[model samples]
Target chain A: AQSVSQHNHHVILSEAASLELGCNYSYGGTVNLFWYVQYPGQHLQLLLKYFSGDPLVKGIKGFEAEFIKSKFSFNLRKPSVQWSDTAEYFCALSGGGNKLTFGTGTQLKVEL
Target chain B: EAGVAQSPRYKIIEKRQSVAFWCNPISGHATLYWYQQILGQGPKLLIQFQNNGVVDDSQLPKDRFSAERLKGVDSTLKIQPAKLEDSAVYLCASSLVAGGHNEQFFGPGTRLTVL
Candidate 1:
């Protein structure tokens, strides 16, 4: 069965630190990738998405993800993190269907 | 534009009891989705609707779970004889289009606790 894997379960970092959350999916062929963030007490919102474009895609809130098709990976990156960036992040893939499959979330804790 | 809306922010019920959750998608949205998020896990898609018709429900446990989208705007998800494993956050989302690139907008989920 197709699945998504998130390498980090939880991460802690000080403010202004660079961040990278790993995401990989088990699928061959075409796929649509997405990154979503859920802040404390807020609903999940789309941070970015990738679909038949340049491998590198930029998203809201200074977030970006690189879709490496060879590795089946789409890793999220942020050059500088703020305390407000602390939240749960999820990676998802939509392929050939209406429903999307999500990876286990990564919880990032940014300390000031 | 208003995001998706869900009712009964929380629900608790005894095992074997039946319960239902409601959702209202954004105006002009052509697609709606329901997802189940267990503690410490990613949200899993349970159903997808295009207008009043279901587009995909392959992951839904049809044995006991049922959902409906009336008037192609609002929806309801029901579970008969709820089980303990059903305890989780039920999320509702909607998108303007059904194509692969459309991003979904989510609502505040209904946290269900099946005791």
Candidate 2:
């Protein structure tokens, strides 16, 4: 079965600090990767997605992810994060259909 | 446009009790999905529906869980004889298409607590 893995279970950082959350998928075939974020009391929203073409995909709120096929990794990164970035991050992958396999999730707390 | 809507945001019930959750997908969305999210974990897909037909229910525990989308617009997930391990947030999502390339819009989710 296809699965996603997020190494960071919890992360705490001061505001304006750089952020990088590791994600890896187990599938070897054609895959579509996605990063979703959920703020406290808010619904889960798409952070970014990689379907094809570009390896580096930019998403809302200055978030970007690089899809490295060789490593089976699509890591989410931000040069500088804000206090508002404190939320739970989830990495998901889809082999073909609408079904999405999600990782255990990473909880990030950005302090002011 | 309104996002996916789920009713009974929080539900608390005893083990062996039955509970149901309702979800209304976005207008014109051809695909609807239900997922389970336990605390400290990411959401897991339970079932997927395309219009009034079922697309996938591989992960669903059919013996204790069942879902229906008769009108192809709204859906309901019912858990009979729930167990303590069934406690989780039920999320409903919708997309314009059934493929993975399309973006999926999610609801606020229904949190279920089985005592």
**In lDDT terms, which candidate is top?**
2
lDDT score of model 2? Answer: 0.96
Query: DockQ for all models, in order?
Result: 0.82, 0.90
What are the lDDT figures for the candidates, one per model? 0.94, 0.96
lDDT of 2 by residue, A1-112 (tens): 7999999999999999999999999986799999999999999999999999999999999999999999999999999999999999999999978889999999999999
lDDT of 1 by residue, B5-102 (tens): 99899999999999999999999998999999999999999999999999989899999999999899999999998999999999999999898788
Best by TM-score: 2
fnat, candidate 2?
A: 0.88
Clashing pairs in 2: none
Docking class of 1: high
Worst 10 residues of 2 chain A by lDDT: A93-102
